[model samples]
Target: MDWERFARQMATMAHDLLEQDSVVGTLERIVRSATELVHGCDAAGILLMDGGRVRTLAATEPMVDASDRLQERLQEGPCFDAARLRDGERVYRIENMTVLQQRWPAYAPSARELGIGSMMGFLLFTENENLGALNLYSRLPGRFTETSETAAWVLASHAAVALSSARSHAQMTESVATRHVIGEAMGILMAGHHIAEDTAFNMLRRHSQDRNVKLREVAREVVELGALPRPEQPSRQ
Candidate 1:
């Protein structure tokens, strides 16, 4: 592959994704485009760790989906090991899945049965945060070579940046919307109760703390349902 041409094409893809302004759409484009760049690999996928489990965030082919499921079900595979490794460590391949079955017996046979004979996985991270892993699979035995490993690393780096950017954009959008809803709810409380702004905010905060619910949720309920139940008065003993 011509490095110059590839770089230019990847740059164009990144620019197009940025222009779309939709996180999910951008991620879908990224995974598909990256699968094309890494040669000889039959499929590509991105796995993300959420709530303590790995889940397929995006995949380019059926083989990729099968590989991801194998890892998810058995909790072991190149991708899982790669993501758990220390920064800069790479799990390039599982030579002889049968012999290696001692380490990940459950994952090896299933992965091999899926027609995945060779694999390369790169840990996806940004600064201190470990996002997950990007995996590539091949049907031929010993399919990934030194050159392919290097290419996988490059693709993984690009994917990390794109995934992080998309996630950050999504979080910012959600935060802004939550703030808007809370502000509107506060206004409603102020008008309905003839209370000062600070008092209304404090009431919401107190309710949120007491119930262990998010401030945004409490505010949303206030706005949507008009009023919350007041704490009942205690009778004199």
Candidate 2:
């Protein structure tokens, strides 16, 4: 592949991913581009890890989905290592998993049985956090080369920064909405009870804690009901 042409294609993809309104849409475009742009990549996917749980954000093929779940269930594979940032490795390229029988044990033989010949994974992360792994799979042995690995790594890096930005934006939006709802509920309390803002907020918090409900839930209830519900009586065991 012409490096110049590839770079131009990547530039366009970067613009699209950044401009995407939703995180899922951005990730789906990224995964699809990997299969089309990366040399020797027969399929592509994104693996996301939250806490200890793993999920596939996007996959170009069902094979990619199966592979991701296999890695998750067995707790092994290049994707897992790259996503988890274990051993401080940002990328993992496997030309042949058969040669890594001892290194991967269960995952190696299992991947071979699934018809995976070679694969690569790169860590998707930003300065503040690690998002996950961007993965590519091939059906032929020794499919990935240094050039392809380098290209995939660059793509993954761009994806990581975009993912981080999108997530931050989403969190900020949710926080703002929550604050708006809480403020509305507080205003309702103040108008009904003639209490100060601080006092109204304190009452809401006490009600939330006493009822073992989320503050947002309590606020929503107040906004809908125009008053807090009576506290539940303790059950006699």
* C-alpha TM-scores of all predictions: 0.84, 0.90
lDDT of 1: 0.74
RMSD of 2: 2.2
- The 10 consecutive residues of candidate 2 with the worst lDDT sum are 123-132
* lDDT, residue 10, candidate 1: 70
Which candidate has the highest TM-score of all? Answer: 2
For residue 216, model 2's alpha carbon misses the true position, in angstroms, by 1.8
lDDT tens readout by residue for model 2, 191-228: 99999999999999999888889998899999999988
How many clashing pairs does model 2 include? 0
Q: Write the per-residue lDDT of candidate 1 for residues 24-97, one digit (tens) a residue.
A: 77667766766677676777777775434777777877788778777767777778777777355765466555
List residue ranges in candidate 2 displaced over 4 A.
50-52, 98-100, 126-131
Error of 1 at 187 (Å): 0.3
Which lDDT value does model 2 have at 121?
86
